[model samples]
Target: MVQDTRELNRKAVLTALMMSRPASRKWIAEASGISAATVTRAVDQLIAEGIVTETAEIISESRGRRAVELDVVSNRSFVVGVDLGASNVRLVVADLLARPLLALEIATPTATTARELAHWLASTARTSAGDVWDRVEHLCVGLPGAVSQQKRTISNAPNLAQIEAPTFLDDVENAMGRPVGFDNDANYALLGEQHFGAARSASNAAMVTIGSGLGAGLAIDGRILQGDHGLIGEFGQLPVGPLGTRLEHMVTGAGIIRRAAEAGIDLAAPSQLFASDAGPALKALRAHFDQALLIVLTATTVSCDPQTIVLGGGIANSLASTLDRYQAALEQNLRVSPRLAPAELGDFSGAVGAVVAALHKVYADLGIEEEAFVSLPGGDALTHERVQAARR
Candidate 1:
C-alpha cells in the first residue's frame, strides 16, 4: 500500500512535468498537489531513470530562490504509428514527445489474408524508420474498424480484408517485436485535430470522416468518448438516407460513385461528381450528398452538442463550398449548432493521430491520461493547474 502510494505520487509529479516542462520543483509540487518532499523524491527517481532530467535554473516564484528546472527526456525512445485506411496506409515514426521523425502515405496493399497485411505493415514501418527503427519501443495502429476495449482485436472493419483473422494482432506484434495498441481510425483523426489541427482550442468537438466510408469520432470535455461497447461514434451504421439506407451508402466515396453510375453518369471518382456546372444527374447527386451530410451533422449536434465539428477524410475539403448550406439548415433546426470547419491535416490526420495514440500509451504507464493541452514537442505547454481550472 505504501509502495502504491509512492508510485501514484511519482506519476502525479511526472504528469505535472509533462504538462508544463522546464518547471521548477516548487511549480511541480503546486501543480501536482503533491508535497514538496514527495515531488523532490519522485523527480530524483525519474531523473535517475533517464525519463526526466534537470534543465536550466529558474527563479522560484514563492521563495525568490534559484531552483533547477526539470523536463521530460523526449527523444529517449520512439514509437511507430500506423493509419490503415480503406484506400491507403499512412505511417509515422515519432519520439516519446509525439514529434514525427518520418512519415509515409502509400497505397494499401491488396492482401488476401490478415497475416499478409500485418507483415506488410511491419516491413513498411521498419523501412520508414530506417536507422531510427532500433529505438522504437512501441507501435500503435489506427484503422477503420471497431476496436475492442482491450484493443487486442478488431471487428466491423469493412475496409480491411481479413481483419478479423484470429492471429492478426499477434502477428503484428510478433513481426514488429514490440507492444502494440489500436484504436478506431476516426478516433485517431479526432485526436490529430485536437492535438495539432483545427480543434486545438475546442474542448468538445466531433470529427466526421467521409471517405471510402462514413464514420465519426467524438470528444467531450477534451477526452475522446469511447462508449461501453466502443461504438459510440459508429456513424456509418446510422440509417438516415432515402428508404432508410445506411449513411455509409449515401455520402461515402464508393456509395456516391455507385449512385452516380446508377444515375447514368460515369464518375471517375466521387470528387468528379461534385465538379462545377452540374448537369441534372450531378445536381441530383449533390443534393442527396448535401442532404445526407446535413442530416448527420444535425443529428450529431443534437446528440453530442460539440462546440465544433471538423469535417475530415478524403472528400471533406471538397465540400467546403457546401458548408454554408449545411450550417444554414442546421441553424433552422437547433438554437445553437456546432461550427463546421475543414480538417487542417487533410488526409494525414489519422497518421498524425496514430502518433498521438502511441505516445499516450507511453504516458499511460505514468497514469497520465490524454488532455487537449498536451501538445506535440515544441508546441504550447499548458500547466496542469490551468487544465484543472478550465475544467472547474
Candidate 2:
C-alpha cells in the first residue's frame, strides 16, 4: 500500500512538471497538492531515472526562497505522427514536448491490402523522419475512419476501405520496428485545435471536417469523447429530408459533384461547384450546401453543446464566404449557439494533432494519466503558414 501511494505521488509530481515545466519544487508541490517532502523525494527518483532534470535557471519561490527549476527531458526522444488520408499522407516528426521538428506530405500508395499499405506507411514515415528516425520512440497514424485502439482495428472508412482490418496496427508496428498508435483523423483534428488551434481555451468543443466526406470529433471536459467502439462522432450518416437522404450524400465533395452533374452543371472539381455566378444550377447547389451544413451544425449543437465548433477539412475552407450565414442561422434557431469558427490550422490540423496524441501516449506509457494534454508551444509555430513551410 505504501509503494502504491508513493507511486501515485510520483505520477502526480511528474504530471505537474509535464503540464508546466521549468518549475520549482515548491511550485510542483503546490500544483500537485503533494507535500513538499514527498514532491522532493519523487523529483529525486525522477532525476535518477533521467526523466526529469534540474535546470541551471533558478527562481524565487514564496518568502524569497531561491530554488532551481526542473523540467521533463523532452529532447531525449522523438515521435512520428501521420495523418493518413485516402489521397495523401501528412507526416510530422515531433519531440516529446510535441514541437514539430519536420513535416512532409506524400501521395498514399494505391495498395489493395492493409499489409501493403502498412509497409508503405512504415517506409514512407521512416524516410520522412530522416535524422530524427533513429530517436523515434513512437508512431501514431490517424485514419479517416472509426478506430478501435483496444481491438487494433479500423472500420467505416469508405474512401480507404482497403486499409481497414483487425491486424492493420500490428502490421504497421511490425514494419516500423516501434510502437504504433491509431485513431480517427477527425478526433486528432479536434485534439490539434484543443492544443494549438482555435479551441485551445474550450473544454467542450467539436471539430466538424467537411472534406471528401463529413465527419466530427468531439471533446467534452477537455478529453476526447469516444463512445463505445470509438464511434461517438459518426454524424455524417444522420439522415435528413422526407427522402431520408444521408447527410454526407448532401454535403461531401463527391455529393456536390454528383448533384451538380444531375443539375446539368459541368463541375470538373468540387471546388468548381462554388462559382461567383448565381445561375439556377449554382444557386441550387449553394442552397443545398448551406442547408446541409446547417443541419450538421444544428445537430452538433443540440447533442454536444460544445463551447466552440471548429469547421475544418478542405471543403470548409472553400465555404468561407458563407460562414456568416451559418452562424446567423444557428443563432436564430438555438437558444445557445456555439461559437463557430474556421479551422485555424488549415490543412495540417490532423497531422499536428497526430503529433500531440503521440506525445500524450508517451505520457500515458509513463503512467501520467491525470493530465496528459500536450501542445506545440508557440501559437504562431503551429500556424498553417509555418507547417506548410516545413512540408516537403
Candidate 3:
C-alpha cells in the first residue's frame, strides 16, 4: 500500500511536469492538486532516477527568490522516427524532447518490400543514433497507409505493393530491440507541425502534404482527429476529378510529372519539374497547380473548415514561389478562405511527430495522465472567432 501510494504520487508529479513547461515545484503542486511537500519529494525521486533535470533558475521579480525550473532530461532516452515516402526514406534520431540529434535520407526504389525497407530503416537509425543507440526506447514509422486503430495493422497502401503477411512493424522492432509505434504519414506530419511548427498555437488546422503521394492531416480542437479507423484526413482518395482520379492523383509530385508529360514536357524526375530553365515545363506545372489548388481549396472549405491550411511535403517546398498563385486561386473560389502558409518544419514534420508520440507513450508508461502542451478547444467560441479572422 505504501509502495502504491508513492508510485501514484510520483505519477501525479510527472504528469504535472509534462503538462507545464519549465515547471516549478509550486506549479507542479498546484496543477497536480498535490501538496508542495509531496511534489518536492516526488521531484527529488524523479531527479535521482535521471528522468527529470533542472533546466534553469527562475527568479521571482517581486521577492527576488530563485526557484529551479525542471524539465524532462532528453538524453535519458531516445526515439527513432522514420518517414518512408514512396521514393525516399527519411530518418531522424531524436531525444525524448523530440529534438533531432541526427538525420538521414535515402532514395528508395519502386520495388522495395516492407521487410527489406524496414531492415534498411532500422540499420540507418541505429547508425545515426551513435553511442545513444542503446538508450533508444521507441521507434515510430510514419508510412503512407491506414494504420489500424488498434495499432496492430497497416492496410490500403496500394503504392507499397500489397504484401502477404508482411509485418514491417515487427521486423523494425525486432531489429532495434525497442517497442515500435506506427501511424499514417500524413497524420504524423500533422502532429509534428502542431508540436513544433507553425500550427503549434492553432486550435483547428489542416496540413496538406504533396509528395510522391498526397494526403492531409487534420487537427480539430487541438487534438488530432483520428477517425474510427485511425484514418481521418485522407484527402488523397477524395474524388475531385473525372474518371475516378482522386485529389492525390491530380495534385501530387507524381501528378505534376504526369501532367507535364501530358503537355509534351519530358521530365526525368519530380525535382527537375520545377527548374526555371524548363520554361514550357513551368507553364505546364502552373496549369496543373491551378487545377490542384482549386480542388484542395474547395475541399478545405467544405470538409474541416480549418482556420489555417499548411502546405507541406517534398513538392511544396520546391515550388514555394508558386504558393501565391495557389493561394490567390483558392481565395478567388472560396467564400471563407483559410489562411494559406508554407509548413515551417519542411520534411522534418514526420520525425518530430514521431518524437511527440514517443514522449506521450513515455508518460503513459509512467502512469502520467496529463497533456504535455496546450491544446485548442474545438467548441470554444474563441476558436470560431479565430477562424473568422483567418478567413479575412
Q: Which stretches of model 1 miss by more than 4 angstroms?
A: 59-65, 150-153, 367-392
What is the alpha-carbon lDDT of model 3 when measured against the actual structure? 0.71
- What residue pairs clash in candidate 1, if any at all? none
Quote model 2's TM-score: 0.91
Clashing pairs in 2: none
lDDT of 1 by residue, 85-182 (tens): 86788777777776666667788886657888889889988888889888787788887877776656777777675776767888988888888877
For model 3, residues 292-367, the per-residue Cα lDDT tens digits are 6678656765677777777788777776777676667767777467777777767767766766676667657756
Candidate 3, clashing residue pairs?
Answer: none
TM-score of each: 0.88, 0.91, 0.82
- Candidate with top lDDT is 2
lDDT of each: 0.78, 0.82, 0.71
Quick one: how many clashes does candidate 3 have? 0
Model 3 misplaced regions, further than 4 Å? 1-8, 20-23, 30-33, 53-69, 109-111, 156-158, 162-165, 228-230, 263-285, 373-392
Q: Global CA lDDT of candidate 1, please? A: 0.78
